[model samples]
Target: METTSSVADIQMVTFLLGSEEYGVDVMDVREIVDITDVTKVANAPSHVEGVIDLRGSIVPIVSLKKRFGLPEAAAGDYNCIAVMDFAGALTGFVIDEVTDVIRVARRDILPPLELGSEPWMEGILSLGPRLIVVMNLKHLA
Candidate 1:
């Protein structure tokens, strides 16, 4: 059996969704860009708003808000799309704003609880005054 190498530390891109803070590994992030010109896809899931032509490739966008069943944002609410490499394909996730790029040590991340938390959540990072939900979207994708 192959043993997995442990991540001693990781840098993350933190962002806001509703009032909660969320993060994903910075290496998974391709780019952060403003949301615009999303072409709606018919018969797709509600969380999947549509796809966008990023440079030349067509990448699908998913709303973390709708995916998590959070209340919809107000009309004209400011949002940015985090283009992330999930599994292998690039997908865009909508977030309120980019908070900060933080480096989290392995000691600071609590193992994800099975109850009341989504399976996609890898761990919860507790550092100083900030508690962030760190997502492992590879499982979901």
Candidate 2:
């Protein structure tokens, strides 16, 4: 069996989604901000939570959990918005908490195993003792 390497090998920003660890390519992330009140929009998609006044322009927010069909995270706890610019669109993703910025090299990344009924997991990447699930945020948008 191939062993999982250290988190240092993955070049990414690690964050918590409930108890599971997730990562995204560092270049995609723009900034992190604490959770703030978002103005709800009418007739918006179900996955779209709302939009926030990010500086001068309104940035749309998406519930990552909802997008992935995961349970909604409870309020009044550690919450953050990871802002990313993808394909000329600026969107924010709500996460449980921001963890660390580590570098996991491409060599350490493993292909997705053929599970009988795995959900929409992007792929697997080494992160210390455990394998972190890489999420495809572009698909979420």
Candidate 3:
């Protein structure tokens, strides 16, 4: 068992997709907002869904489903777009829902078990009965 002090050392932002629970480093997350209208951009990469008029600037939104090669997500399923800043660009990731913020320990967290196979699993950290998928945001963004 891990102690609270140890667990609190590591913080993560949790979210839900389908029935699965996933997490990303809280530091990478800039803001979370409800689903917004996305304007499709022609000639953009398939992974690049399009850009949205966020405030006054056009921000790119990427579907986590499409990025991971998962099937197309049903319309209206997502409730939040978790924006992350990487390499000076702000990218929004569409997720089913924002869950909670919690902490875990470096020791309690496990590495990517399917790294060799999945290549994108990054790592896996067990948080109680829920296992959080630690994504490599640098590559993801």
Candidate 4:
């Protein structure tokens, strides 16, 4: 069977975080869930919002805004939790909105080196007039 590695493209799940567009490898995403109540954990990392009971499993939730030191999403803005497997663990990250699932060609993706040292950025892809930031999800874990 032909695989993603055998192909010239990668499928990415795009989402919004504070007006910025970000994308991650779709294969790593477990599911996307509506925003849920999170029980705050004491002494947890600053970026960690808290934990949520997903079915019978407890999943830790991290706020991308907080992790990146960005301003919080304004009140009444819709948010969702992106459950992805990263850094050897399954973590849920809060996102502003899910935009699309796109097949990005390797030739269309530019290495982050062009933008200098941005540890959290994996690659950059331009879609018409919009520039999509492909993120290194592993860094969030």
Best-matching candidate per lDDT: 1
> Model 1 segments beyond 4 Å from truth?
1-7
**CA shift at 79, candidate 1, in angstroms?**
1.7
Q: Which ten residues in a row have the lowest lDDT in candidate 4?
A: 112-121
Judge candidate 2 at residue 49 and give its lDDT.
91
Instruction: Give the Cα-based TM-score of candidate 2 against the true structure.
Output: 0.82
Candidate 2: give the clashing pairs: 6-128, 7-128, 9-103, 9-104, 9-105, 10-103, 10-104, 11-103, 11-104
lDDT of 4 by residue, 24-131 (tens): 999889999999889999999998989999998899999888887789977556489999987877899999999999987878889886545468788888999778
TM-score of each: 0.90, 0.82, 0.84, 0.88
Give candidate 3 misplaced runs (Cα > 4 Å).
1-8, 114-120
The 0-to-1 C-alpha lDDT of every candidate, in the order given, reads: 0.88, 0.78, 0.77, 0.86
Model 4: residues with Cα > 4 Å off, grouped in runs: 1-6, 75-78, 113-116
lDDT of 2 by residue, 29-80 (tens): 9999899998999999888899999998799998877776787876666489
Give the runs in model 2 whose Cα sits over 4 Å from its true position: 1-10, 116-121
Residues 1-141 of candidate 3 have per-residue lDDT tens digits of: 865475347678888766677788788899998887888999987877788877887889988877777776677777788888755788888888888898767666677775353544557877568777777677654
- Pitting candidate 1 against candidate 2, the one with the higher TM-score is 1
